[model samples]
Target: MDPADVLNVRFHYGGEFIRIGPSLDYVGGDTAMSVLERDKLSLPELKGFLADHLTVKDSMKIYFLMPGRQLVNGLLFLHTDEGCMQMSEHITDAGVADIYVEYNGEQDEPEEDASGSDFEDELDDLMDNDDEPDAVITAEEEDIVQGNVQAVNAVPEQDILEHILVPNEGGVVTEIISSPVKHNIRVDALSQGSLPRLSRF
Candidate 1:
């Protein structure tokens, strides 16, 4: 009776996932893992067995996936040897075991270049900038408008002459020319019918 007949084990290490089926009859089978967790397997032997599937260098790290997404690292030799079966039971239902993998690249890479970017520089400058050119133009326009008003107001006043109306026998109205020094007109010598009365409009 072998424990390998009762378990389907899966491991994730060295950027590769290794699945060891219960029997070689399945798609992927590990004859090496079949010998693991037995009383005959040792620490060096397990590491060497893993080396055939993964890069097992000096200071290599190994972690087991536990229940509720917890992780237990292989720190102690004896404890790590036993943790394989214990941790494997937590990941799969009944007798099967597997681990989850994810890439957290987005959350880690943005922290470095966010502050010094061109967009941030432009935004900061826009937020901090201030000045009003329209107000300055309005002030200058007001000064020119005031100067034009003042010039119009300073114009001297001139006397306006009022024309006097004279009535004649011909039933026509005419203006008396009193200011102009000119030749006298012989109105008494002319016939009354020949006298012009109405002024040209």
Candidate 2:
């Protein structure tokens, strides 16, 4: 395993978030980045940097560490400026996140259609309710939601700290939910971001 072999690279076994990509002027070419470098860049930039260095950007995927030291699929970075989330904000200075480089080619076979199309269509119809008027919401609804969110959305400082602590891995745990369930369990609300809508009302 020569260090120059970019197709099959793995970073050091540290950090809560194990970054799977190639080295970008960090570490001794074994890991993707150093602790200081990981802290300097925001999470989005770190992802972008990885994509920029890859020959197979399309196959690249990102993962973030969650509560209880679990790795889960992260937001896909379509563009460099998708969001302004800082790595330091979530990861601590002493935290050690590693990056692994590997081959990520597209699937050879095309995706097959699911067998539950009819059932899915029926569910969609029930949920969409197209017959309902599009302009159902009034200014009053927006005002109430905005007021409620602003007043009650502040996450407790300690609770926030709790979310960032991964069990065995290193790096800072800046933000996350209390749950350890994988991406399969996330709904639109929890998946959206921190401070998910507490209520639909």
Candidate 3:
């Protein structure tokens, strides 16, 4: 995959976190203007790349590399529909400049449980039993399931960005780097109104 397509992307390598940004290019002619060139990837491409490359498991603590080679700790969550969109928005808004992925080794597999086979057999038996009445889930149970789904789908974009932008302890929320042209203006306008300013850096 092209390195220019991703922004502020992180991957685990050799037990360390690696941050990636867009590729740089020079503009044609004598002007000698440097340009940040980024390539865009579709959802399928992104998913496929992640599936093929990422080694760390979901919710793993990973490092994010800053401009000055500073490393900060952050949690890595599995990408969902909302998460993918949020990540894309963050990369664009943050004006990230580099992007790359490296695979150093195979991912560590989860430990096997002794009762796993028995549990699978039981589940299969339950599925094969046609004479048994189907188990009916209650309304409350359905609501609980729906709530869990929503929770999983709700990508905490602000929290993740805040962690990335302001890594020091006791750092003020306002210290985060807001999207210079769009988010900051909207936040300033809202601050002027009845609503208090909610930082979106």
Candidate 4:
């Protein structure tokens, strides 16, 4: 298949990941889809590769890697009697180029000096050490700051979805699957108050 016709989807698992370039030639098929990588493998073959290499279990974290390497979090795979698997419809609908999976035993440790308490202390110290001691906070300045904060806090849930759904300049949004399973994935992500910012993606 032509490289232009393939959609590159990356699978990140436990510090190791594989990029599978599935052909956009067909929509839904029980048969395997073509892939482009170092060792070319089909969609089903790639799934089998993940099953064998990554530890599949319940409670695993899944994320869609957006453009510019931004990770939109809170996507989780369904764990059935067979194994953990993301709905095939969801995959095709998102038209995602990358998928990050945090399986059991593949959790990343926090970076050194990156704990929440340490961050808070650092911020507090910075605020306390004002470069200009004579600087006074005018009423207008206070109002502006408060207004900005309120605007951020008052952002509607649909706004977040719009931010993700709307295509950027010269970019096209792939058709998304409107199944309940896929809808729930997005809803859950929104509920967490951690939607990806427009500027970031």
Best by TM-score: 1
Q: How many clashing pairs per prediction, in order?
A: 0, 12, 9, 0
Off by over 4 Å in 1: 1-7, 16-37, 68-94, 97-201
On lDDT, the leading prediction is 4
For residues 1-201, write the lDDT of model 2, one tens digit per residue. Answer: 332212221232212223455312212222454322422345455554564444334454443332134233432222332222332234433444334433344323446656459888778778888576567768999999898877645644334332323433556544445443332234554567644222211
Computed on alpha carbons, the lDDT of every model, listed in order, comes to: 0.44, 0.40, 0.44, 0.47
Error of 2 at 144 (Å): 99
Worst 10 residues of 4 by lDDT: 23-32
Q: Give the per-residue lDDT of model 1 (tens digit) for 56-91.
A: 555544444444432333222223646654553443
Comparing candidate 2 with candidate 4, which one achieves the higher TM-score? 2
Clashing residue pairs for model 1? none
What residue runs in model 3 are displaced by over 4 Å at the alpha carbon? 1-10, 14-45, 51-76, 97-201
Which lDDT value does model 1 have at 188?
44
Ranking by TM-score: 1, 2, 4, 3
Deviation in Å, model 3, residue 197 alpha carbon: 99
